[model samples]
Target: MPKTAIVPPGTGKPLAPYVPGILADGILYVSGTLPLDAEAQVVHHGDAAAQTRHVLETIKGVVETAGGTLDDITFNHIFLKDWADYAAINGVYAEYFPGEKPARYCIQCGLVKPEALVEIASVAHLGTATGA
Candidate 1:
């Protein structure tokens, strides 16, 4: 199967061995995204709500670059540093997917960057486009 890396503008190189997203067989597999600023430092400090928003926006860029919208997302994998922030994260997350919700799972776990309170990865399908 052929695959293409989905890298939007201003993505600034990641410090790992993976691309932001990969498009394979019309399915976009987004890597776990962190709430990091341009310098790759964690953002929002100890605020999980703000960090969740940033992570979602970063995922938005990857999905858009793959020619898909947030509504096209079928699943999401969310990781949180603390379960106490679950409600706050969901509050901000609902705003992004206001319509039909996607299949998802959230868990409390340690992230690659200790300062990052939340991380998210998603899968979206952008069916082959029809001719204009």
Candidate 2:
């Protein structure tokens, strides 16, 4: 049977979507997180690097709620409104996944929200199956 995990909305930050995360089988799928604060307002204005860090931090919370760690991340999908900010984004991304990096794909496109420059979603392995 499959189970679902719920990431409670953060306090003093912003009211994250009621459904922040969900897990199925051994895969934990996190929603795209932006640099929005507790009030659902964007923070770290005009700084792509800072925004990226904020988004990643939010992802960390979601991952933990799903009973997984950053090391368990297997894949990451990044959406960016400006390709020119790739270097800045990478700087922040490296800080989060310092050693073993997950498989990632970054694309330049229009984000659903105007103020959001980048949004990241991830899939992680939370089960114990491993090669002997």
Candidate 3:
């Protein structure tokens, strides 16, 4: 199966050489998304909840562009700048992934940007290959 890079219009271009997501073999592999705007500058500053929302929204864009939805996500890799923001991040995260949640693991670590409180990478299965 040929792979396709997923880059939705207005999504921030990362400093690194990587696409926001990649679709191949019926699955979308979303890269670690940070709370950045279209210019790739971090947003929400110290607010973990808002940062989580931004990150998830970015992931939503990637998956949606690749022909999937939040419900199609099967797993997530969450990264946090501080453990103190866990609950706050989860609060916003729940809003995006309501019921049966995807498998995820979060860890405290230094992010690419000091102001970025949360980052998330996701995997979504569309079940069938799209011409993406």
Candidate 4:
């Protein structure tokens, strides 16, 4: 299978030397996404719910660009700056993956950006495009 870098539009420039997402075979691997806006600036500040939503949305965009929706996500790795915000993050998470949610692991970790309370990475199965 061909390996393709999947970088969706409107994501702005990356802070690190890495692609936003990559597609290999039928799998899509999205890089750890922070709560950055289109200009790559930290958003939502200390609001964990909003920040979590932003991070998930960023991952969603990359997954869709690779020809799959959020339903195709098989697993996700979430990092939170504070364990106290766990409930707030889960509240927003429920809004996205309501039923039969994907496998996920959440842990508290120090994010690269101080204002970023959440970061997420995902694996999705996009299968073959209409005509690969």
Local error of candidate 1 at residue 110 (angstroms): 0.7
lDDT by residue (1-132, candidate 3, tens digit) is 688898998766578999988888898899988899888898887889988988888888888888888999999999998899999999999999998999999999998888999889999998775724
**Which segments of candidate 1 are over 4 A away from where they belong?**
129-132
Cα lDDT tens digits, model 2, 6-112, are: 55556344354445677877788877777788787878877889999999988888887777788999999999989888999999999999998999999999876
lDDT of each: 0.90, 0.81, 0.88, 0.88
Give the 10-residue window scoring lowest on summed lDDT in candidate 4.
Answer: 123-132
lDDT tens digits by residue: candidate 1, 14-95 = 9789989988888888999999987889989999999999999999988888888899899999999999999999999999
Q: Candidate 4 on 12-95: residue-level lDDT in tens? A: 889989999988878889999999977788999889999999888888889888888899999999999999999999999999
| Candidate 2 wrongly placed segments (more than 4 Å) | 9-18, 128-132
User: Candidate 3: where is the Cα deviation over 4 Å?
Assistant: 129-132
RMSD of each: 2.3, 4.2, 1.1, 1.7
- Using all chains and alpha carbons, the TM-scores for the candidates as numbered come to 0.95, 0.86, 0.95, 0.94
- Scanning candidate 3 in windows of ten residues, the lowest lDDT window is 123-132
Error of 3 at 61 (Å): 0.7
Local error of candidate 4 at residue 110 (angstroms): 0.5
